[model samples]
Target: MPSNAPASADNWWCDESSEYAFMGFSYEVTACQSPQQLQQDFADIRNTFNGRYIRMYGACDNDGFYDDVVNAAWDNGIGVHALIWFGFDGGNQWQQRRDSLVSTLYSNPKAKFVTRGIQFGSEPLFDGVLSPNDLASQIWDLKGQVKSLGIPVTVSELAYGYQSNGGAQNVLDAQDYLNIHMLPFFDATASTSNDAWPIVQNNLQFFQENGGGKKMYFDENGWPSVTSEGVQANSGAAVADVTNEAGYYQLLEDHCSDLKNNAQGGIGWFAHIYSDSQEPGYGIYDTNGNKKFNFAPRTYC
Candidate 1:
């Protein structure tokens, strides 16, 4: 019973015995925050929220940023959904990001344990910053480098981006799993409605139809509670009512069991964000560290 091996891939989501194997939240890095700061947050994500994954969005300029995250992540008993953000404007840091990612995997034995998987690019094709084949090639290249590490790899993109891009299917084939962004707040029909669950279902339907049945998961999905200090969200009939935020998350919490048990192999979702400071009003906790609601997320439904 005491034999030593990780309970999952790179300790993937969480140990098999974990109560929170299916929950996660999106974590963004605008700058190179200290490991102390990052560890504190990671501790909260794992201990307080019982989250098994943290989907990364952006990164600091430092080449060491990747490993910094990895080391801190495992230390807190949480795993990192490593994202080598290509950025929206498509700046030219391909070499840097590549090097950092590879090095991080090799730098520490804990690196792979903390890594949930590697997302080589995030929404790169949506803005035409990268071609489908080009993105796929990058994904394969990274896969080769990390073959020994055995980390699952993917390139995140919108459902439409995958549907419309000429070689999108190729990119989909290249990755080990489907990494898609499903945000109801952007949907015209859902954004204005009191109930976003229906639209969220539609979003998942879109992915599954084109997915060819590959395992899929949402890297981002949630509703913003506010657009500004006084301004409410303005997506047609949508207002700034803070209750809407809880509604979206509540649905996610409710269906966690269905997602894991689905025969189609859905990997579950990571909430859109962690705190309001990073994103105006999308956080579970506001700027003052007060929760918008009293409910907690449960991955097992």
Candidate 2:
């Protein structure tokens, strides 16, 4: 994919190995697979994808499964944005979580090097778990302790959540980057596939201004490849099909130039997931190990 914009090396977000952004995993759910199975899956991803970054959910607990995840990621030459899950307001449990996470990191210093960033929580506000001010204070306090470790930290929220007037503006004010999930297919207006990029572009501008001059990343974005029998319901809207799902990937490859150009404000856009799982819908690979039409082969542009 040749680009009208400067080369990938000139783009700030480009990794030495690939032009694509990070990959994501539903770790809290998927890591439950057998260690051998998970290791193989990790190996397959490293051998196939050009990108070196990955995003994972949940802390390093639950029988040390996340420890295996981190070890496998390091073994396969990938970095991770590890998340600490939050449900409701935790009172004293918040400090306990911070302590546990710190202990995990302390125990696995080698694996910790592979951690690209620390995500406090994923869509905490959307789930009505905490107010923006509460979330921001949490993020700021965590950053105070962890920032000295030399990695960026932030939270993930829906696209509009990064806006100046949105409930998560305080969270936006606390992080180093504008980390957002841009899912146009789920928008109430319910646009077609072709409208996805334009929707993304428009949201980026909104986020850029409201993010307090911080850089941004589409930490999660992609349409579900399943149709008919397996359509994942979107807050009660019609299910997205292959037409929209596959088109989303092609649209990304076709506009790689615009994506890398700093004129658009240099954003890193990660695909929603790596492989199929019990979660259903968004995987670029089926549970049978087949690639979906939306599986674009990423490479240095």
lDDT string for model 1 (12-104, tens) is: 443333333245788878857788988988888888887877988777767677777877776777777788877766677866877877886
lDDT of 2 by residue, 37-65 (tens): 66676677667665556776444445666
Off by over 4 Å in 1: 1-22, 191-194, 228-235, 261-265
Alpha carbon lDDT of each predicted model: 0.72, 0.63
TM-score of 1: 0.87
Clash pairs for candidate 2 = none
Candidate whose TM-score is highest? 1
Q: Which residue ranges in model 2 land beyond 4 Å of their true spot?
A: 1-31, 58-60, 87-97, 162-167, 227-239, 263-265
Tell me the alpha-carbon RMSD of every candidate.
3.6, 6.7
Instruction: State model 2's lDDT.
Output: 0.63
